[model samples]
Target chain A: SAVISQKPSRDICQRGTSLTIQCQVDSQVTMMFWYRQQPGQSLTLIATANQGSEATYESGFVIDKFPISRPNLTFSTLTVSNMSPEDSSIYLCSVEQTGGNNEQFFGPGTRLTVL
Target chain B: LAKTTQPISMDSYEGQEVNITCSHNNIATNDYITWYQQFPSQGPRFIIQGYKTKVTNEVASLFIPADRKSSTLSLPRVSLSDTAVYYCLVGGPPGAGSYQLTFGKGTKLSVIP
Candidate 1:
């Protein structure tokens, strides 16, 4: 298991502004992903942070709004651009180590409240 | 698209066993079933993973039937700490393609005294 941490554990931002969440893994990871969990709702996969390239986003999410960067194996960032009240959710980053069968280890989520 | 289905909630007494079932009708050949436990204000934690038959760990046991369309997560000797949400995840093994996981609405287990 890897030790994963997210910066700015909770934040309140104004609508139309942007906030960037950072995820740092203790060791190198094979796959890094960002997820969103709304109030009283299940998690939704936002994008897969691919190292040295653009992130692969899931449907209903776009790169223009949620731009991600994975510079190396142990670090990544997800920036929520032009935030809105609807974007107020808990954002989490997870890592699946190499040779594992998708038993992902997740970071303590960043709670974003857009006012 | 979510790939698994589970119950909405359950209630069990302390010291009793609780079994939560999940259904994956369109599970692919390479897909595996994994269970996760989530507490309030915390991220989901890996509980168990099974491809077929049964898989057991210190925390819980997973029972997968022959058809592989459904699986059961058995928690022996429930406690107040076990009161949380449990998710059933199904996805292909880590590989070049088909590695991302899709989560469904998990079952919320409430433990009674």
Candidate 2:
């Protein structure tokens, strides 16, 4: 497991605004994922970011809305574009480990509030 | 990913063992049962995972039956700090496959003091 950190742990934004959350892993990992957790709801996969490639987004999510960047193996960013009240949620990044149970370790998460 | 069904919520006392059962009858052969614990305002942390039989680590245990249709996550002598949302997930990138997972509504465990 690696130590993952997210910048701007939380933020308050107005409708139509955009916020970019940064995720930094202490060690390099092959798989980095971005997940969104709405209030009182389970986490949903937003996209998979692999270095040197475009992000692969899950259904109900698009690159235009949640743009992702994976410039290197240890860092990535997710930007919530044109935010709305319904976009208020917690954004987290996870890194898949190599050995053991192959568990995915997550960052503390960025709490976004769109008013 | 196999769809999972688990209790919405449960209440227990401190120092008591807690078991959360998740149903995944359609689980595929390659799918593994994994459990995650999420505290308020934080991302989920991996608890345990198993394919069959039982697996125990320092934090928790994962029990899977022969049918692979269901699994249980057992936490020993839970305390107030154990009160959190527990999620049961099924699936993983099967061998250079996709890096995606599906999460279902988890069981909320409230450990009372």
Candidate 3:
């Protein structure tokens, strides 16, 4: 089991503004992913953070809206730009452990509320 | 990626064994079946994973048939605290660069006293 943590456990931000969430892992991981969960909805993959390269965004997500950075293996950041009420959701960071199965471990999650 | 199908919700009594089945008819040969449990306002936690036959862990057991088209997650003697949304994912193991995990609606397991 990997120990994961996220900054700003819960935050209330104004609309049209932006918020950057941070994810930290105790051990180095091969791949890091960001997810968004709207109210009463399942988790949606936002992007895959690649170390030393550009992140891979999902189909519905775009780089202009959600930019990801993974400078190292243990840390990554996700920025939600031009936030709106629809963007109020739980954002999570997940990592696929080395030498482990396809199981992905997730952080505690950052709750973002846009007003 | 193989699309998964599962019940939207399931009701069970305390101390009863609950089995939630997930169907993935288009699963690939290299794809493995995995389950995760998620409580409200938290991240999903890995429960079990299996390729074929049955795999058991301290938390739960995964049962996959030889065809690999479907799998079952059995929770024995569930308690109220065990109520959560259970997710079934079918994908290959890591080391393939980036494999996005697509989660379905998931089965919301409710344990009633």
TM-score (2 decimals) of chain A in model 2: 0.96
TM-score of chain A, all candidates: 0.98, 0.96, 0.97
- What is candidate 2's lDDT per residue for B52-92, written digit by digit as tens? 99999999999898998999999999999999999998886
- Give residue B84's error in model 1 in angstroms: 0.8
Would candidate 2 be rated incorrect, acceptable, medium or high by CAPRI criteria?
Answer: medium
Least accurate stretch of 10 residues (summed lDDT) in model 3 chain B?
B91-100
Residue range with the least summed lDDT across 10 consecutive positions in model 1 chain A: A95-104
**Best candidate, lDDT:** 3
Candidate 1 structure lDDT: 0.91
lDDT of 3 at B39: 97
Candidate 2 runs further than 4 Å off = B93-100
Index of the highest-DockQ prediction = 1
Error of 1 at B68 (Å): 0.7
State each model's CA lDDT, in order: 0.91, 0.90, 0.92
lDDT of 3 at A95: 94
Return the lDDT, model 3, position B98: 30
Interface RMSD of each: 1.7, 2.8, 1.9
Residue pairs clashing, model 3 = none
Best-to-worst ranking by DockQ? 1, 3, 2
